[model samples]
Target: MTLHIYNTLTREKEVFKPINPENVGMYVCGPTVYDFAHIGNARPVIVFDVLYRLLKTLYPKVTYVRNITDVDDKINAKARETGEDIRTITERTAAMFHQDMAALNAGNPDIEPRATEHIAEMIDMIERLIENGNAYEADGHVLFNVPSMPNYGALSRRNMDDMIAGARVEVASYKKDPADFVLWKPSDEDTPGWDSPWGRGRPGWHIECSAMSRKYLGDTFDIHGGGHDLVFPHHENEIAQSCCANKTDKYATYWMHNGHLMVEGEKMSKSLGNFFTVHELLEEVPGEALRFYMLSAQYRSPFDFTKEGVREAKATLDRFYTALRQHADIEADDVAAPDHFVAALKDDLNTPLAISILHELLSAFNKAPSPQTKGHLLACADILGILQQDVEGWFTQNTAADATEVDADQIMGMIEERKNAKANKDFATADKIRDDLDAMGIVLEDGPGGTTWKLK
Candidate 1:
C-alpha cells in the first residue's frame, strides 16, 4: 500500500503525494543548543527519522533538513549564567546534541543548517516581508504585521484572541498589535549580533526556521514536522511569514507533529526529579532501548515514559536478539518486508501496530528458522530502526541494573565449577553455585551451544 500520513494542517489522514516524484523535501525543527537535549526532545527526532527511512524506500531521493538554533535567548542566558563565551556554549551544546542523537541511531539529516550560519538568509526573508507590507520596523525591531495576513492562524486554527491567551505573547509598546511577533531584534554588544538592514541584531526564534527551511527546501516543501507544542505562535508565525514573503498560498504541503511526551504519569519537571536528559539516561539504559520505548506508543499519542517501560522494551529486544543469535548460522536471502508489516507503517506510522507485527514475525521465525524467515524479520526491524546491533553484543551489554562493574572472569570461573559439579553428579554443589550466582543478579540460560550468563 502507498503511504498515508495524518497531516496536522488538514486534521485528516491523506495519501502522501510528492510534489516532485523524483525527490521529496522535508524540514523538521531541530533543537536549540542551550542545554543537553531532554528526553522530551527526542520524540520528534525518532518519529521523523522513521518517516525519512520510509521515504527513502518509496522515493529515489529525500532531502531532510533539520535546523539547529544556536542563537537563542536560552543559549544567551546560559552563557551569562556560567560566564562562558556564547560561541563556546552554543558549539559545545550543539556537539552534545549531535552525539546524543547519534547514540539513538537517528541518521543525520541531509542538510543541518545552523541558525547563526543562515543569518544572511534570515535577513533577506525579513526584508522581503517588510517590502511586501507584511512586516514593519519599530524601535530598531522588525515585527511581522499579523493583521496584514488575513489568514494568519490558518495552520493552528486558533483565533487571534485564543492564540494570544495561549501563547506567551510578548507585550511591547512598539508592536502594532498584541498578536504581532518579532522578526528581528537589536542585540547589545554582549549579545551575538549580525549586520542587517534593520541593525546589528539577531533573528527571532520563529523566523530562523522559516529562513533556513526556505533556503534549503525552496519556498515550499513536501513535509514539515515538529512536536505538537510548536503548533502555536512558532508554527503559526512561520506560516504567515513564509507565505507572505514568498507570495504563496501554502508554505508546506503536509505538516506532521508528534504528540507531547510525559514522564511517569506526570509532566516532566526538574523540581519533581523526573526530568531526564538523554545524556544522563544513556548512563543507565541503552539508547536503542530508549528508542524502542519511545516507539512503543503511536507517534501521535501522548507518551508516558517510565523506567519500567524502558526495561520492558529492553527485554523485548533481548527476545528478538536471542532469536537472531539462534539463527546466526543461517545464510538468509535479502528480501522485502511482508506487505502487511509495511502497510502498518504506511498507515500514519502506526509503530505500535508495526511492532506487534514484528512479534508475530519473530514467533514465525522461531517456529521455523530458515533463510527467508530470518531475512523477513531483519527487513521489518530495519524499517522500525531496531535489531541492527550485534546479537552477541546485545546480550552482553550492561543494562540499567548492571551499570556497576562486575567481574566476568569470576562469574565464568564459578560457571565452570558448576558445570564440573553437574558432570560429577554433585547436585548439592551445583545448586549452591546456581543460588550464589542468582543472588548476584546473574541469569543463566542453557542451550545446545553451552551455558550463557547475563545480568538479571
Candidate 2:
C-alpha cells in the first residue's frame, strides 16, 4: 500500500510521493529554546519521530531536519526578566530539549540547524524579498508586505479581515499594513543582535525557518511539519516569504500538522497547574509507556493525557514484555513485520489500528510460544518503536518503581530462598518467605518453569 499523509496544505489525505525517491527530505519546525518543553510541545516531536522512523524503513535515504530557534524576542525577554545571560538560557534550555526528546526515543535529526547560525542566510532571503518587492524596510525594521502576495493567507485560509483581527495586537507604527510581520527588528544594546543591512538586529521568527530550510532542504522541499496551532501566522508567513523570495509557486510540497494535547480533559497550561514537562512525567512513568500512550490516538486528533491512562499503558507494556520473558529461551528467527501491521501504519500512521494488530500478535504468541511468532511480535513492536527493552529490564528497570527503594537483586535472592525451602519440604519456611515477598509488593508465580516474580 502507498503511504498516505493528511496534508494540511490540501486538507485531505494524499498519497506521499517524494520529489526524489533516492533521498527524502522532511523539515519540522522545532522549539524556541527559552523554557522547558511542555506536554503540548512534545506532541509534534513524537508524532514526527514516528513518521521519521517510517520514512527510514521505506526510503534508502531520509534527511530529517528539525531546526532550533535560538535567537528570538522571547529568549531575550526571558533573559531580561530573569537577569540570566541569553546564551546561558538558550544553551541550557536547548540541552534540556534534547534530553527530554531522547527519553521519548525521538532520534536526533539528521541535520539540526540553529537559527542563530543561519543569520547570513536569513539576511540573504530578506534581501531577496526586498529586491522582489515582497518586503520593505522602515524605521530600523524590515517587514514582509502582507499585500504583496495575493495568496498570502491561502494555507491558513484567513482573509484580510481575519488576519487584521488576529494581528491587531502586534501592529507597529512602522508597518505599512496591520498584517505585515517582522522579518528583521532592531535589537537594543542589552538584547542579542547581529549586524545586518537593517543595522544590529535579530532575524524574525518566521524568517528563521524559511532561511534555515532553504539552506538545508533547498528553496522547495518534500514535507514541512509542526503543531496545528502554527498553521496560521507562523507557517503562513514562512510560505509567503519563501515562495516570494525563491520565485516559486510552492514552498513545501506537503504540510503535516499534529493536533493539540490536553491534560485530563483540560487545556494544559502552567496557570491551571496541569502543565507537565516530559522530564517531570519521566519521574512517574517510563518513557516508552508515555510514548505508547501518546500514539493511542491518531496524530490529527486532539489527545487528553491522563495519569490513569499512563498507568494503564505501562501495565499493557508489562503484559507484552511478559510474553517475551516466557519465550526467552527460544531463538527468534529474523522476520519482516506483518504486512497487516505495515498497512495500518502506512494508512496515515493509524497507530491505534497498528497497536491493535500488535495486540493480536501478542495474543497469538501467548497461546503458542515459538521462535517465529516471537520474531514477528518483536518486528511489529520495532516499527512502533516499543518493546525493545530486555524482558528482565522491563520488570527491573521501571521508572514507576524506585529501583533504589526496592533492590531487584535482593528480591531475587528471597525468591531463591523460598524455592530451596519448598524443595526441602519445609512448608512453614516457604510460606513465611512468600508472605514476606507479598508484603514487599512482589508476587511470585510457580509453574513447571519454576518461579517468576513481578511487582504488584
Candidate 3:
C-alpha cells in the first residue's frame, strides 16, 4: 500500500504524492539552541526520522532539512546569564543537542542550516513581502500585514478573531492590525544583527524556516513538520510570508505535527521538577530503550514518560533479543519487510501497530525449526533497528543495576568460574552459581564463545 499522511492543512488523511516522483523534500523545525533538549523536544526528531527512513526506501533521493534556531531571545538571555558571547553559548548548546539526538537513534538531516547563517535569505524574503504589500516597515521593524493574506488561519483551523486574541503580537503603533506578526525587529549593537533594507535588524523566528526551506528545497516542499505548539502563529505566519513572497497559493503540501510529551501523567514543567533532558536520561537507560518507549504509542497521542515505562520497554526488548540469541546459528533469507508491517507504518506512521507486527514475526521465528527461517527473522528485526548489538555486549554493558560499585574484573572472574564448572560436568555447582548470579539481576548466556552475562 502507498503511504497516507494526515495533512493538518487539509484536515484529512491524504495519499502522499511527492512533487517529484524521483525525489522527496521534507523540512522540520529544529530546536532553539539555548539549552539541552528535553524529552518533549525529541518526539518530532524520532517521528520524522522514521518518515525519512521510509521515504528513502520508496524514493531514490530524500533531502531532509531541519534548521537550528541560534539567534533567538532565549539564546541572548542564556548568553547574558553566563556572561559569555552569544556564539559561544549557541555553539555549545547545539553540540550538546547533537549528542542527545544521536543517542536516540535519530539520523542527521541532509542540511542543518543555522538561523544566523541564513539572515540574508530571510531579509530578501521580507523585502519581497513588503514590495508585494503583504508587509510594511515601521520604526525600524518589518511587520507582516495579516489581513492581506485572506486565508491566514487555514492550517490551524482558527478564525482570525480568535487568533488575534490568542496570538502574542507586539502592540507597536506601526502595526495596522493586532494580528500582524513581526517579520524583522531592530537589534542593538550588543545583539546579533545584519544589514537589511529597513535597518540593521535580525529576522524574526517564523521567517527563517520559510526562507531556508525555500532556498534548500524550493518554494513548495512535500512535508513540513514540527511540534503541535507551532501550529498556530508560527506556522500560520510562515504560510503568509512564503505564499506572498513567492506568489503561490500553497507553501507546503503536507503539514505534520507530533503531540506533546508528559511526565508521570502530568505536564512536564521546571517548577514541578519533572523536566528531563535527554543527556540526563541516557545516564540511567539505554537510548534504544527510550526510542522504543517513544514509539509505543501513536505520534498524535500524548506520551507519558515514567521510570516504570522505560523499564518495561527495556524488558520487552530483552525478550526479542533472547529469542534471537537462542537461534544464533540460523541463516535466513534477505527478504523485504512484511507487507502488513509496511501497511501499518504507511498509514500516518502507525508505529504502535507496526511494532505489534514485529512481535508477531518474532513469535513465528521462535516456532520455526530451520536455521534459514531464523535468519530472515533477524533481518526483519534489523530493519526496525533492534537486535543489532552483539547479544553478549548488550547484557554486559546494560545489565548492571548499580554500576558504580561493581568491579569489571570481579564479574569476569565469576563468569570464568562458571565456565570451568560447566566444562567439568559439575551440573549442580554450575546451576547454583547461575541461580546466585540471577538473583543479583545478572543473566548468563552459554554459547560457542563460552559464557556471557547481562544485567536483568
Candidate 4:
C-alpha cells in the first residue's frame, strides 16, 4: 500500500516514497522533560506514534528516533523553583512522560536519544556549519547564519522580513542578522554546560534535533514530525542547520506536524486554569478514553478537549467492550488490518476516517452470525490499538469503593447474590443489581471463575 502524508514543507498531501524502501528512518522532536506532559503535549506523541506504527507495517525495517531534551533553560528554571538537582528533575519527569505515553498505548520509538548524551555529535555538527561558513562564533556563542540558507523560511512560508518583524529577536551585538538563531550558547557557572569548540556551552534547542537525527537516522531521513508550534523557528532552524551542515538538499523527505489542542473552546493556558497534565487527567479518566478522544478528530484539526467529550469517548469504548464481552466465545483470526482502515490511515493519518471505519466494522460484527465475526472485529481493533484488555477486566477494575468504606465480605456477598440471580434465570434481578452497582458508576463482568467489577 502506498502511504501518503501531508508534507508541511510543500503544504500538500504527497505520496510517501521513502529514500530507501528497505529501511525507513523517522525523527520526531520530543519533550523538554522538565514537568508533566499535558494533554496538548500528548497530541504529537500519539499522532506520530500512529504514523510510526503504520510505517513499520509498510516497510521491512523502520527506525523511529525521538530525542529527550534533558538539558534546557526550562530544566534550569524548574531546578531553581523546586530546589532539586537538574538531573533529578529531568529523570523523574522523563520517567513520568514514558508512563503517561505508554498508558495511551503509544509504543516506544526504536531509538530514544538524549541531548546530553549526544553533545559530541551536536558539537561536531556545529563545527561543520562553522567550516562551511554557515555559522560563526561571537560572544562565546555559535549562531547559524540564516541568510546562508536561502530556503530558511520555506517550511513556514514566512519571508525573512516578516519573520524578523514577528519574532522577538534578541538584539545581540554578536548576531549578524536578526533571523540568525543560536546553534550553541555559553552556559553560566550554574547552568548545564559541556566543552565545545566554542568553549563551555550547551546546544541550542534546534541543534539537538538536527544533531540527534543525523547521528541516528543519518543526514536525510524519510520523515520528521512534531507539533505545529515547532514549525516556525524550531523546525525551520533544524532544516537550515541540517541541510547546510550536511550539504544535502533534503533533510527529511516528509515533514508531519499535528495541530494544537484546546480545552473546551479556548486555548489551554495556565492563566485560563485549564492547563491539564496527563498525570492529573489520568486520575479522572482512563488513559484509553483519552487516546480514543484524541483519535476521534483528524490529526491536523485543532481539537477541543472538554470533560463531556472525554465522557462521551469513554461511553463509546464501553459499548465496544460490552460487545466483545457478549461474544467471548467468538475467536478472532490473526489478519492484517482491513484495506479501508489502512487506506484511511495511509492518507495522511486520517484518524477520524479510520475511527469511522472501525465503528462501521463494529456495526457489521454486531449483525453478523458467524463465530469468526468476533475474531474479525478483534483483528480490526488490534490495528487501532484498542480492545486489547481482557473483556472481563475492563468492567471489573474501576468500581465504586472508597478504600475505607467497603469490607471484603460485603463485596463477596454482593457478588454471590448476583451470581445466584444469574443461575436461577432471574435476569431481571441480576440486571437490577448490576444497575444498582452502575449507579455508583461500577461495571460488572461475569466469567468462568466468577464475576468481577470495576469503576466506570
After superposition, candidate 2 runs with Cα above 4 Å error: 167-169, 398-404
Please write out the lDDT profile of model 2 over residues 1-456, one tens digit for every residue. 999998888899999999899999999999999998888898898889989888888999999999999988889889989999988999999999999888887779999999989999999999999999999999999999989998988888878888778755386898898888999999888878989987999988999999999999998899999999999889999999999999999999999999989999999888999989988888778788889999999999999999999999999998998878877888887998888898898999999999999999899989988888889888888878898676877776646535436787788898889989989999999999999988877788776688888767
* Two-way TM-score contest, 2 vs 3, winner: 2
For model 2 the TM-score comes to 0.96
- The true-versus-predicted C-alpha distance at residue 447 of model 4, in Å, is 11
lDDT of 4 at 434: 84
lDDT at 267, model 1: 99
For model 2 the local lDDT of residue 5 reads 90
Model 1 off-target regions past 4 Å? 399-402, 407-414, 424-436
Over 318-355, each residue of candidate 3 has an lDDT whose tens digit, in order, gives 88877766666665666777778878889999989988
How accurate locally, in lDDT, is each candidate? Answer: 0.91, 0.89, 0.85, 0.85
TM-score of each candidate? 0.96, 0.96, 0.93, 0.93
Candidate 3: residue 226 lDDT (0-100):
92
* C-alpha-based local distance difference test score of model 3: 0.85
In model 3, the worst 10-residue window by lDDT is: 398-407
Give the clash total for candidate 1.
0
- For candidate 4, the TM-score is 0.93
Candidate 2: which pairs clash?
none
Report model 1's TM-score to 2 decimal places: 0.96
